[model samples]
Target chain A: MAEPTPELIQRAQRGDPESLGALIVGQQQYIYSIAMSVLRQPEDAADLTQEACMKLLRVIGQYNGESRFTTWLYRLVVNLGRDELRRRGRRVPEMPPMSDDDGEVIDPLQSLADDDRWADPAAVATNTELQGEIRQALDSLEDHYRLALTLYYFEDLRYNDIAEILDVPLNTVKSYIRRGKERLATILASSESEKIQPPRTVAKSDVPVSQPRLARFAWALGRR
Target chain B: MEHCKEYRTNLALRPDGDTAELSQHAATCPECAKAAKRAAAFDTVVQSAVMPMVPDDLTARLLALVPGLAQPMVRSKRWLRQRRAFFAISALLSVIGVAVLIYGLYILGSYVGVSEIWHTQ
Candidate 1:
């Protein structure tokens, strides 16, 4: 749960394998989650996590330590994910329509009356199929918004850190979260008459593939 | 109600329990009250779905693959892995050898008038 330390990163750059492994293990979940949010595919997320870590391994010496390691690392990760999206012909950050009054841009989700299901505990909790609905809602969002949402709730990152990682204005990141959440509410709050029909969660036959990894990670760090 | 919209946006950004302003605003304004609930529900759904349960081998697997870590592994861990493999093969061969020897002895006993050797122990 601890952020990668400056000393740990320095040790890794000095070519200590244990330290290197520790650094990647520290952020493995975060990297995978970020990739999953962008790619929306678990296998792809895993692959990206591995790829990003290796990329860092080689390039780590060049890391001038100018920024928090994560901000720099995540920038590399987001770019890789975005590039893959572009290669796949899936446009990232497909911006929603912006409404303006005589010149100033306004929050798009501002106009709609709040949906009923937004607050309905039963609908959210009881809809055994709601996970699919949630994933679909995430899919509908632009890449930037999805990235912000994932970092906010999944990584538990502060908004300012997210802005720095995404290399965007702080206000833009804030707007992205606001709009993304609103869009999700709209999607999840489908009228009872017209339900959303989307793909269900993929069934993973094998799971918790790495309980030992977390343990070993701790073990390796203690070896310092 | 219109000014309450700003409060609703702020309400949505933070988690449900942290902001007292959300409770107060939602109490006075029907819209924010509903927005708060929906936002909470959204948070619940996203958190559950987005969280990753990763493979435990991730770090080990990467360490194995990394160029710097590629230097011959810690001698003891390698020895342990090799020792395990060696024992497994030895046990398998021992079982097979014992079965074959027993069958051969039984065949020889029948031909050499030593049939009693096949009984008792």
Candidate 2:
């Protein structure tokens, strides 16, 4: 999502209804994507997205512009996601907070890092089978790994931005991505093996890939 | 062989880094070259998987909320407008009523002869 202009953000902070509507409309999809990555269910994600928007409307005046708006918005969504997970009786794993010393020590090798590879959107759009397998694999990951991977690859956030959002050290973000990818690779490899087996009835453990729902409401609104 | 291990570790840890030296090593090493290719392919798949297709109704659902969320603010504006209208109407009616009462009193006094009543008083 394009970052809402600073003027728009300022207007929103001052409780301008048009600006607030624009801001929320622009961010709704992004919020939903983050929610889906965390909750792994469409209904839950949708509910979370609505909750976040409502919460944003109520608390937008409190925004101080001390950080990037997206960063602040991300923190909001992440916190809400955490709370929702907790409400569902899921354990939101706590990573150690970044100490001042840890925060100050930036790795020289990390400075040289260029881990910005992302899937080509056109390519991803066509690879339905691989996408399904990957989604299943992602769904099975722990919350931390899933969240880091989603923010890094999908949101295209830098490691430092992710660290700020996740409230962890920079190295911790890297560790999550690396370990997350490793686990994903392992899962995909195993799934590939299972796919090669003789045809059998669908098992209870199998999950079907969810179909993307087209926004009929959006289309209707546009026509109006 | 040692370089191969280092290259693979770097590939796994930081797949898309400024790896000019690593690329040079991989070019000379067949095993590392194959490893790099596989790693690239895997990264692509993982990225595709992690990025979800957001539901279509999400934006509409959210925008639908904007009006409700903004209702309290809107309600206050409407109330203020109504209050201002009420006050203006009240003030205008009061002025007209007072003017009519004064006119009627003046007409009564003129008919009754105010000079005669003042003399009697």
Assess every candidate by TM-score: 0.63, 0.63
For residues A160-191, write the lDDT of model 2, one tens digit per residue. 77889999988788777766666676676667
Each model's backbone clash number = 7, 0
Indicate the TM-score of model 1.
Answer: 0.63
Candidate 1 wrongly placed segments (more than 4 Å): A86-128, A191-193, A196-224, B1-3, B15-34, B55-60, B67-121
- Two-chain DockQ for each candidate model: 0.22, 0.17
Error of 2 at A149 (Å): 0.6
Model 1 per-residue lDDT tens digits across residues A1-224: 43688899889899888788788778887888889888888877877888888788889999997877887888898888888888889877554433212233222333334445445755776665677777777777667677788877844467677788877766677677767666665665553225445423333432245654444444334421
**Native contact fraction per model:** 0.47, 0.40
